[model samples]
Target: MPKAKKKNRRKKYNYNVDRKKLNRAFRKRQAPRIKCSQIRHAWDRTKSVSQNLAEMGLAADPNKAVPIPKFMQPVMKMDIDGPEKKSKIVQKPYVLNELEYQASLPEKQSQTLSRDLIDYVQHMIQNHGENYKAMARDEKNYYQDTPKQIKSKINVYKRIYPEEYQAFCTSLQQEKMDKQ
Candidate 1:
């Protein structure tokens, strides 16, 4: 065979580019006609939705809220009534479901209620039996949630269980943080 033609070396191709200029090209191009302030104002109108976006890790925008120092706010305080009285007077101490308590309220009377206390009373009647059996059940759950047993539970812990509620809150906060 005739001498093979000398192999030609492949020429190296280069795509050298300036990073800054490339980045500028890739960056989001703003509609020059749209004013930045007007865009910001439009975003402000969606404050709640935007806040949720940050919560969902969809945005880096800082929250527009003042941080309340932990010390500034008192630990939670639950206004617990006496065990017996609480059963008779408060929302069912052993409420199995929060939704059910809400559902039990009369469609209209629940609305007429001017304050939370009235709404609570309505909840109590449903959770605790309206009669003696209900009262007994109420007493049982009240004691379960607290230390004092039965009527004593009611009489001894007549004040709101601010400490107990606070403890529960701390536990919940810790649990949430752990989940995070």
Candidate 2:
């Protein structure tokens, strides 16, 4: 009979490393403990607002107290509704030339295509529907984008956000049903 093979026992590896010790290993040194007291006994019994004021020598007297300050007392003495004050009309300091005035005036703001093509397409569908040409012709829809670009953007928006497009189509159908 052949001799039996020798049995070898493997040692168990421990992966339970101390996290706190590991964190402090790379640090400058062990941090100093907080000097503040966790439980404060001095503030256990607190004083009221009136008692605090009296202690600071700022106690107010009700009899001598005025609702308005002395500075505002003079302004309040004048009656607002008594009579309107007379004033002279001031003339223009310099006459404006037509050309200079025109040049100085703010330029008209031009509309730019929105980054959110989905919203733009949804708005166009609600307002314009399948009439791509008429939609492009509208001032609100134009916004630097040509008819072809607008159509392409609409197609892209539909492909990317199918759920929103489906909802929009359903809403339109419901509107038509309601109208009928």
The best candidate by TM-score is 2
Which residue pairs does candidate 2 place in steric collision? none
lDDT of 2: 0.61
In terms of lDDT, the poorest run of 10 residues in model 2 is 36-45
Name the weakest run of 10 consecutive residues (lDDT summed) in model 1. 86-95
lDDT over C-alpha atoms for residue 115 of model 2: 61
Query: What is the C-alpha lDDT profile of model 2 across 6-51, one tens digit per residue?
Result: 5455666658978678887745254333233221111122665344
RMSD versus native structure for model 2? 25.3
User: Each prediction's Cα lDDT score?
Assistant: 0.43, 0.61
Candidate 2: misplaced stretches above 4 Å? Answer: 1-115
lDDT score, residue 102, model 2? 62
